[model samples]
Target: MNDLLDRLRGILLDTGYTIDGVRERLGAVAAAALSREETVPALRATAGDDPLGLLIRLWWLGAPVPARAAPVGLPVAELAAAGLVAVEDDLVTAAVHLQPWESGGYVVSDRKVRPGDPALRPDHVVGAGGASANLAQLASRRPVGRALDLGTGCGVQVLHLAGRAAEITATDVNPRALELARIGWALSGIEGIDAREGSLFEPVEGERFDLIVSNPPFVISPAGRFTYRESGFSADGFCRDLVRLAPRHLSSGGTCHLLANWLHVRGEDWRDRVGGWLTGTGCDGWVVQRDVQDPAQYVELWLRDAAEQGTPRYRGLYDEWLGWFEAEGVTGVGFGWITLHDSGSLDPVVRVEEYGGQVELPVGEYVDEVLGAVAVAHRMSDAALLASRPVLAAGVLEERIGPPGAEDPARIVLRQTRGLRRSVRVGTVEAALAGVCDGDYPLGPLLDAIAELTGEDPSDLRERAPQALRPLIAEGFFHISTG
Candidate 1:
């Protein structure tokens, strides 16, 4: 089996059969079509006896191939041994969708059935998909003594975590997923990732980790349709429960990164509802809501996600989900990342805001910087904050917008070219204040200088300066210099 695995790895590398390779082989049009779950374009593109085409068909397209094939072929017997493929009458079909997924490096997991697949089982394991990649990119790559990957479906997170965490523990509720994860780790020749089968924190009850991460079963569905998604918990219960318990399992100064969904009730404020979960957890949580959809839109999105859209069962599932949401007074659903820090503060700081900006990949470092800024503000007083020297982040840029023939600028916007790609509009005073944050002068004196120049009272300007700078400071527009 090891020899077969070695040969398989060689075949993939020798042929350059990676995600980028497949994209290059098929071109942008066909690769993009496949990304939208429309496989016909990809099928037309890969119709040939070429090694790359044969391999694409065997793995992604699920097309039956002759038992004997050349450099394009996978090791049939070994794949069967690993429960990845099944052969009958000299034709091989993929029992599981095996694809070469690349993140920080090579990560392989059984693919989930998409819109193009003819048949699918409830237990189908998902590969390194968008959600997985999102969480991985959002994960802090800082070296740590130990990490926990909660709900490690097919072990994609485990594979990514292995590179950073010294010791890793992976937990899941589904037994089949655990089985496949073990196979994946063994095939990849990666060890020391302890896989356990239990729900949520039950697997690691008495443990404390330096970092805790999860791409959990947070679909917010009414029933347990798929083990990878549903957890038989009420709407958003799985995610809420996980966030509530994460602080207990994290060591002081540790951080927990999670991808989650929270429902928006009709009359209740979503912030208080989601923020309430972290109450008494003794940890600071910063929740960034990336996308929000109404009840109807949310239902349709997940239905298509499961490739059930336009199927005979689509209507029933849609009705079931929509009806449940309507009955429960759910107006919308928000999806995004929740970052928690184990500060053990009694009055934990919670920042819940919507960020619809373009996201740069490997956002963990950026998040860490923002969190650090927020932490500083949490402890510093308004007077102390106004008295601190400051500077703009390295990626910040400013633009003056007005008519081409105009004298003075009408509006000034500060934009971040990296990280979250956030853009903020500032008034004249705020803009001038941002320009002088050179770390040589404190904001209190700067505001007083501006007030004297503009004929405004320095006392009033001092009060307003810190209040105005608070949001910008917390958002990384201005960094308070400790030196």
Candidate 2:
């Protein structure tokens, strides 16, 4: 199997069957259409007999191609024997979805179940999609001694962790997902991954890792019909349990990145509800709710996800899902990323907030810096913070909005142009403080000078400035200079 996968990898790479290659062949219109799950335009674009074109049609569009069109050295018979493809008569079709990921590797999973297709199998393994990309971007890229990809469906995250982690362990509850993941890893030429089969944290019992990442089956659904997206546990219990159990398996200073959805019940603050998961975990946690949807919206989205819409059971399933939400007192569902850093501090900092802003790509690059800043600001005393010199982060711009020719601006806002892209409204004193925070001088003297210029008492300014600046530091707008 390994030899066959090696040959398959060579054929794919040599034929330019990659994400970029496919996009270029499909062109702009066809590529965009395919993203919407409309494959006619793509099919039309790839009607030629080119090797890349034929491969795109067979694997990506899930369309059969003439067996004669198979490229030389493509081992069609061997692929058929391995169940990677099915050859009937003069046509060959892919049995699994072999996706060309951006990381220069292929992911093997169950073929996509489109609308009007049969209902999904009980143990269907899903291909890498938006959720997988989100968790990948959220995961820190620092080299680690050991890393774990929990619920490693199709092994996409393992591909991302290939070089960064010295040793990798991937675990999943479904044996089918594990099997496909192994196939994907072999095809990608990634090795030495300890693939274990068990439900969440059970396979690697009592072991710790330098990093753990998961895009778990976090959909809050009444029926656990799909193993890839629905945990049998009730009402976001899987995500909650995953969070609470993370710290136990995290080595000191280890970090865990997860994409999850949590319930928004009546008479409960969603912040506290989600934040409660991090309590007593002894980890500095940051939970950001990127999007929220009402019960009806959530139900419809998942229903459409399984391609169940327009089916006879669609309305009944939708009604059943909504009824479950109502019975569970769920008003809405909050979807977002959760990052936990094991700081080994008794006084751990946990922040839960909603942020809908444009952020730069590969947030993993600076996540540690952001979390470190937050921890420092959280623990620092006013006097200590004042004595320290801080610098404004790059890409921060000051915007003053007001009526034309007004003496003073109506509002002053500081906006980050990169990574998180957070914006905050500020006062004159804070604005003045931001202008001079270049790490050349201590914050105390700078606040004193701003106080004098703004006609406010230096004592009062000093008293209020630390609280104001702490948030800026926490959100990556201001970098507390350790130098």
Candidate 3:
């Protein structure tokens, strides 16, 4: 089996069937179209005598290929025997979807059971998608002793954890997903992963990991509809329980990273709701709510995600799911990443805020940096924070704006050119402080210097400087010399 996989990989590489190769072959327009789940452009681009093209069309795009036309170096018979491909009549069709996923090499998962089909099978397996991709980007790549991927569908996270973690464990409730993930690990040549079958935290009971990552079945459903997504749990209960239980499963300084959806109930603040879950969890949290949708919009969005919006049973299913939300008194659903750090500090802080917009991925290092900033701010007294030397982050840029014909700028904006792409408008003191933060001096002395120059009261300057700087440190705009 290993030899067969090696040969298969050799064939894929030699024929230029990798991600970059495919993207180069199909231009940006076709690639974008494929990302939207439209296969027409990809089909048109890959239709040729090109070996890689044919294989891509057959294996990835779900187009059937003549049996005799199987690419060279791929053992068609062996793959068929392995149940990866099915031969019917004179044509061969792939039983699984194989794509060039990142993390050392490609990953495999079940293809859509039937494209354009309204209803999904209960055992359907979710693949490497936007959610998983975002979660990977959000995961820190720091080396760890033990790592766990909860609900590891198709082994995408397991494949990612291969080199970074000394020991890796992957779990899932669906046995078929585990089976597919085992096959994926084998094909990708990733080993040492202890794949187990269970729901969130059940299989790994009493064992703590240095890092835990989950892009779990987080979709809020009417009931458990698809095995890949629905948890059969109550509204967002899986997410809530996962967050609440993470602290118990984390070693000191460990982290539990998750992608989730939380309900915004009537007469309740969203931040308070999310913050309430973190209470007694013994972990400092950084929650970034990327988006929010009303009940109807949430139902419609997920219905479309499941590819059921335009089908014959769309109305009935939509009504049923919407009814569930209505009965639950959910006003909106919030989608985002929850980053937890188990620093074991008694006074743990939970930063709950919404950061909406496009930011760079795998901001894992940035995420870690934010946690460090939080810890530093927590440990330092007001005087110590003001006494620390500060430098502007590398990506920060300043923008001054004013109404037309004005000699002086009316407002100043400090924006990050990379990593989170954060931007904020600042007042005179902050703008002045930003211009001089070259790491040459401590913030306290800097503010004193500014007061000397501006004739403001030093007491007032000292009082407000740390408050303005604290957020910048936490958000990565300012890098302080912690050592």
Candidate 4:
């Protein structure tokens, strides 16, 4: 199988069946339509009988083609024997979905489940989607000795980790998912992944990793109808447990990045509820809620995910799910990313917030920078912080907003134009501080100078400045100079 996969990879690259090649062939219009799962535009776009076009029509579009018209290097008979494709009546069709990922590799999973199609298998291996990309972007890019990809469906995360981590372990509860993940790893030319079949941290018991990344089965469902998305545990329990267990499996200074969904109860604060999961973990944690949905909307979304909307049990299942939510006191569900760094501090800095603004792509480096800044902020005393020189982060803009012809501005805002795009309201003192923070002078002296210019007491300014600047430093608005 490994030899066959090696040959297949060569043929795929030689035939120009890569991510860029496919995108150029499909064009923007067809590509956008294909994202919405509409195949007509793509089918029309790939009507040519060329090798690339044939591969696209066969694997990507999931359409049957005449066996004689199969691409020259594609091993139809071997693929059929390997259960990757089916041959019947002089026609060939993909038995699985093979997609060219942006990392210049392929991922194989069960065929896309469209509405009105047959029900999904209980152990269906889902393809890489938005959640997979989110976790990948959130992971730190720093080199590490070993990495763990928990619940690695189709092994997409391992492909991204191959360049940095020396050794990788991919684990999944479903055997089929592990099988497909191995196939994906082999085809991507990635080797030596310790593929294990177990739930959560069981496979790696007593072992630690320098980095861990997971896109777990975090759907808050009443029943575990499908293994790919449903954990079979109670509402949000799986995600919470994963967060609590992750720190123990992480070596000192290691980081864990995960995508999760947590319930928003009617009478409880969602921030406190989710933040409590990191308590006593000895890790600096950051949780960002990107989006939220009410109970009804959440139920409908997952129902459609399995293509169960057209089934006879759809209405009954929907009602049952909503009822379970009501009984469990879930008012809504919040989906987001959870990042934990094992800082081994007695007082770990844990931040939970909602961020719906635009952010820069490929945020792995930014995440590492943020964690380093927060660690510094948490460790430094007021005197140490004031003695340190700090500079404003690049692309930070100061905006003063007021009505026309107004003498004084009503609000002053400092906004980041890069990763996270965070904005904070500020007073005149902080605004002046931001304008002069060039890492040339210590903050204490700078504050004294500002007080001298603003007719305030230097002693008073020094007393209150550290409290105001700590958050800015932690959020990456300011970078403290080591020298």
Best by lDDT: 2
Model 4 alpha-carbon drift over 4 Å, by segment: none
Ordering by lDDT: 2, 4, 3, 1
Candidate 2 lDDT (Cα, 0 to 1): 0.92
Check candidate 2 and list the clashing pairs: none
Report RMSD for candidate 4: 1.2
**Runs of candidate 1 exceeding 4 Å displacement:** 1-3, 70-74, 104-111, 115-119, 344-347, 402-408
For model 4, state the Cα shift of residue 76 in Å: 1.0
Error of 4 at 360 (Å): 1.0
Better of 1 and 3 by lDDT: 3
Q: Considering every candidate listed, which one attains the maximal TM-score?
A: 2
RMSD of each: 2.2, 1.0, 1.9, 1.2
TM-score per candidate, chains pooled: 0.94, 0.98, 0.95, 0.98
Model 1 TM-score on a 0 to 1 scale: 0.94
lDDT of 2 by residue, 1-483 (tens): 999999999999998998898888899999898778898999999998889999999988899999998988889999999999999998999999998998879999999988888998989999999999999998998999999999999999999999799999999999999999999898888989999999999999999999999999999989799889999998989999999999999999999999999999999999988899999898999999999999999999988888999999999999999999999899999999999999988899998899978788798998999889889889999989999998989999999999999999999999988999989999888788789999999999999898888898999989999999898888888888746
Candidate 1, 397-482: lDDT as tens digits: 88999999998899999998887788899987788877777899988888888888889999998887777787888888888975
Worst 10 residues of 4 by lDDT: 370-379
Candidate 4, residues 1-483, lDDT tens digits: the string is 887889889888888889999999999999999778788999999997888888888888899888998878788899899999999998999998888998768898999888778989999999999999888888998899999999998899998999999999999999999899888888888889999999989999999999999999999888998889999998899999999999989999899999999999989999999999988888999999999999999999998889888799999999999999999999999999999998878889888889888889888978989888877877889999889998999999999999999987999999999988899998998899899999999999999999999999999999998899889988888999857
The regions of model 2 sitting more than 4 angstroms off are none
